[model samples]
Target chain A: MAASSRRDGGAAGRAKAERSAWVLLTPMCLLMAVAFILPVGLFLLYSFYRFRGGRLEETFTLETYWRFMTDELYLITIYDTLQLAVLATLLCLVISYPLAYAMWRMRSPGLQKLIAFIVFAPVLVSVVVRSYGWTVVLADQGPVNFILTRLGLTSGPVSLVYNMTGTVISLAHVFLPFVVFPILASMLRLDPTLREAAEDLGASWWKTFRSITLPLTLPGVVAGAQICFTLSLGSFVTPAILGGGRVLVLPIQIYTATSDINWPVAAVGGLCLLVMAFIAVVAFGRLSQYSEAV
Target chain B: MAARIARAGRLPAWRHLALGIFTVAAVVFILAPLVIVILTSFSAQSYAIFPPEGYSLRWYANLAAQTTFYVAALRSLILALVATAASLVIGTMTAYALVRYRPRGHSALKAIFLSPVVLPKMVLGVAVFMLVIKIGFYGSSWNLVLTHTLICVPFVIAIVAASLANFDWSLQEAALDLGSKPLPTFLKVILPQISVSVFISGLLAFVTSFDQVETTMFLMRPGESTLPIEMFLYLQRWQDPTIAALSSVLIVFAIFLLVMTSLVLGRRKITTLQTSAEPQP
Candidate 1:
């Protein structure tokens, strides 16, 4: 009986220890609740508020949703937003494919490291600085246009900034590292045996790439594209700086609404951006599944 | 067969040249604006002219002479430090609980913690600003610090959790069995192994907090700004050589960061530095 009582005491001690462990976890749980979960929750709720006469009504309504659905201006913002994200992702993919391929092909780890470093170095610098740098490069008298004019590629320096071209180019450049790493990860995971088998079967290099390499690495490409799209969708600083006020993406719209103190409109714009980003995430998930299943 | 061989040989050569040029041009393109800013800083006159009429360092001297930038710099640094400390505490605790406590709903908890990674900072800024105003907690440095910590926690949790995953739990078990207190066991055994991740995440947290502009923009009471905000305001007001001088300083700051990164990560694998901290399984 005494031995059985001691055994019960042992179980009780174990339970007590775990209870203390739960106690230790309290700070973290509290923080996430207050800081992360609460802010986002409170933030999202403003979307349902009415902003009549520049004053936000505390009462909840779906009028903002209706406005978002019915308003042509909001619809145009959505269209422009998707177009920007898609173009940015496509450009990033085109740039990253060769870059990642070269990194993967090199046998020397040292060379790989150096190339990777160069690609990622810009991320350490401020995005504002990088964007500012592009404004100079894309300016009419900037080095890019200067070189083009001297080389007779253009009659004069064409307008780059305050338009879609500069925005896409810089956005792609800014996101190049994000895209490259995912694709490179996928490429590195490719089985060398498959390529060798293709070559042995009398397939040419291009044929091997098309049949074996491309399809195998398609998952990574999709993932990289997904990241680029979502990031570009939420990107505010780059478009603001390079777009020179011509670009009217959702983030900028949200910012303007906030500045104008129209919480309902800003909230609605933010929700729309959030929804688009959510869609991109969902689409990316589907693409990954399809790629893997294929 | 001869035609096929010729086509194959020529194609690789062309592709190689094309790829090489593309690579070089892209790097140059990425670095060009920064280079131009450096050059413009040395201009004798007060305009953004490339290949300046003559070279001088007057703007840089003027940059050194600005007091507001100094204050803003200090504020940014302090705010980042406070936020980093806050995140490390919360993230470390959360990572421990999520990993070690055998908790139900771990995944949901993690998703909540990490949601800000995809959350637009501008939206959060607007929302928080409104909420704070609504709650009558408007325009305090505490508000900025708290909001910034929320954004910064996900990065810390990610890195620290990964490092913890790599840690040998048996050692932790051994310590616990040998009658070490849980906190001390974590401190003496687990933390040392995961210190590298903690340090990296801390640096990242510092940088993210310091470099924030858009989120902090609305939060800044007029004339009280972070360095990036200050630089942004200065840029908006004037595009003169003085701004170039300030940018050159920022370029130096970038170089300083690079050197610091190498010193910290030189012994570590290149792949680890390039990769974002892996999500904890």
Candidate 2:
């Protein structure tokens, strides 16, 4: 009886220790729960709230959702947001691919290291600084316009700053590193034997690249695009600064709405951005599967 | 082979020259604007110009004259430090739990934990703003700390978990069989192995938390803003060389951080090349 009692005591002690472990985890878990989960969940709920008379009505109505569907302005904003994100993401990928490839193909390790630093150094700097820099570069009197006009490319320096072109160019610059690194990682991870085999089969350099290298790195391309698209969709700072009051992405629209005390519309807009990002993630996951199959 | 070598030598003559030119152009695209900002910081005039009429240190001097900038910079520094320390402790603990303990439904819980990465920060800002207003914690520094904590936790978890996943757990078993206490076992055994990851993630969190703009924009009251929010708002009303001056200061600060971290990290390379530095479990 004493033996059984002692065994039962040990079991209880183990259970108590496990409970203590969970108890120790409580603060952080609570921090995440309260600050992250609750706020975002509440925001999702707030999208259903009714905005009336320049005030927020905390209700369960789907009026905001219905309004978003019926409203042309909202639809247009959504369309513009999608178009901007897609174009920016594509532009980033196109530039990053060659840059990453060049970095990958370099025989000299020192050069590779240098290129990597140059690619990623801007990320450590503030986005605001980079955006401000682009504003100067793409400005009417900036070096770019000066060169364009000097080359007789145009009759005058074109209106580049405070426009969509500037925003897209700046954003592409902003997200370039995110795309480049992932592709480089995949390129480095590429099995050398396959490339060697392609060479062994007497395939030319271009053919080897097309058949062996490109397919292997498609996953990286998809991964990079996913990051760029999702990030661009939610970007607030660049569009606000470089957009110069002309470009209107969802994040800016949401910001404006929230400032106006239009909680429902802001929430709905954020929801759309969130949904668009989610779809991109899902779509990329699917595309990666197809790439793997090939 | 000689023919191929000849072709390779000649190939560098034109095509590779073009390639090198393109690469240099890309680098210029990345670097020139930053160079302009740094150069403009030394301008004699208030307005931006590529070739400054003359050079002066006045803007940097002017930045020193702003008391508000100093206070805001200090506050942001302290706040980011607090958040970094807070997230490091919690994040390491949580990552350990997720890794060591085979708790049920860990993956789903992890996904939930990391959802902040995907959830738009503006949405987060507005939501937290409304929630705080309702909960009566609207203007508190804790709100900022909490929000930044949420923002930074995923990064910490990702880095630490990646490191811990690579760790050989048999070492833990060896420590335990030798009769070490769990707490001591963790500190003396586990920490040194993953210290690199912890420090890197902590560095990243500090920078990210310190650099927040849009989220902190609404969170702070007008006079009581953080540094980045202060600068962001200041930029709206002004386009003077003051910002260029401030940016140059920020550039110096970033350089200081890089130097400090390099000293701290020692042999570990700063570039985040491999997400996991060590081999995976």
Candidate 3:
């Protein structure tokens, strides 16, 4: 009889703990419901609403999605957005890999910490500030032009700012720290003994890096790339400040549409952006899994 | 440097030299924009000219005279603080629940919570704007705070969860057995251990919210733009050094934050940085 009562008390305690867990989770659930689910639902709802001339019709239709798919201007905007994201992500990888390799190879703890700090310090600064900084640095009379002119690479100032070159370069810079850290983290997780074994078996440094280190860190590369790609895909400030009224990516298009009170167009553009980001994330997730398996 | 090369294994000397040169180039690439902006802030000429002919404090004086920026900066500060505080509280509760209880489908619930991290900020921004307008809450400050909290809570949850995963629950049980209440036991036992992660998450969340532009733009009135929006708009009209001056101030502020972070993390020397980055299993 005592053992039966004890078992009943244990079951009651387990149930109580579960209740407390739900109680703890209540605020988060409510916040997500009110702020996240509701807003995203309304956003999705607007995409189905019809917009004629200057008025919005509270009706369900696929007109916006159809237009987004059929419109030539939007088709080009989508292409340009993808191009920008891909270019920026590639540039980030190219720069971050070597930098991370150097950090990983460093024997001095002080140097490692300093390098890490330098890479990450930019995160604290506003993106607007960083993007603006890029404009000046890449400007006609900026240091880049100054160096090129002095070196006789060009006879006069080259037009770098307010163009795709400037936009991609700035985006790469903005996301570099993010790209670097993940790669560095993966590098730090490498087994020193594996490299030592490769060395013992007469493998060259480059060969070992290619066969062992690079493949092992490919998951990190994918994670970092995912972040860089998604961020660049939806980037507004840098492209706007640096695009100089020329780059017509989807985010810019959405902003313009919203300003013009074309909610359908804006909503559709946002949905396209969302879909593209989701696709990239899933692709990267697959790539990450494959790399881990390798 | 030679020692570093020697430690890097049997790489050739020329290869090491190449790596060293490339590292210097990469550092320059990272720091050039920031250095140029700081230098430009002192330029006597309004337009950016590398290696300025003369220097002056004119832009700093000009920045001081702009009341709009002052107000916007203040607004951003308060908004970031509120968002950070709210996210920390909500995130901690959720994280503790997930960690301690190991609720069913907990991984799925965690993913749902962290889905915002992958969701494009621009989409979230537009969605929230539509929701607020639809519900006639467009002018309310809580909307902005709530949206920012939503953005920031993921970082807190991710970081705090990772830290809590390593926490010893036996201490909590011991305290409870000693006749302490759950709240006090958590406060006295669990919080002190995870304080460092909490602090780092709070700092990160604050920075994320403060630097928000695409997310906060449509939510605010034209005259009540955040510091970043104000700077963005100002840059569109003018290419002057006044912005450089303001950017320099922000850079200094960033340096201050970096210093504080190092000081705190220096004591702990935890690999929590990596954990914060890849909090998901």
Give the number of the best model, judged by TM-score: 3
Per-residue lDDT, model 3, residue A102, is: 87
Better structure of 1 and 2 per TM-score: 2
Instruction: Order candidates by TM-score, high to low.
Output: 3, 2, 1
Ten residues in a row with the worst lDDT in model 1 chain A?
Answer: A1-10
* Tens digits of lDDT, candidate 3, A229-253: 9889989999999999877898899
Docking class of 2: acceptable
Off by over 4 Å in 1: A1-24, A58-61, B1-14, B277-281
Instruction: Give the native contact fraction of candidate 1.
Output: 0.44
What's each prediction's TM-score? 0.90, 0.91, 0.96
Q: Give the DockQ ranking, best first.
A: 3, 1, 2
Off by over 4 Å in 3: A1-11, B1-9, B267-270, B278-281
DockQ, 0 to 1 scale, candidate 2: 0.42
Instruction: Say which docking band candidate 3 falls in.
Output: medium
| Number of the top-ranking candidate, with DockQ as the measure | 3
Considering only N, C-alpha and C atoms within 3 Å, which residue pairs clash in candidate 1? none
User: What DockQ do you compute for every candidate structure?
Assistant: 0.43, 0.42, 0.58
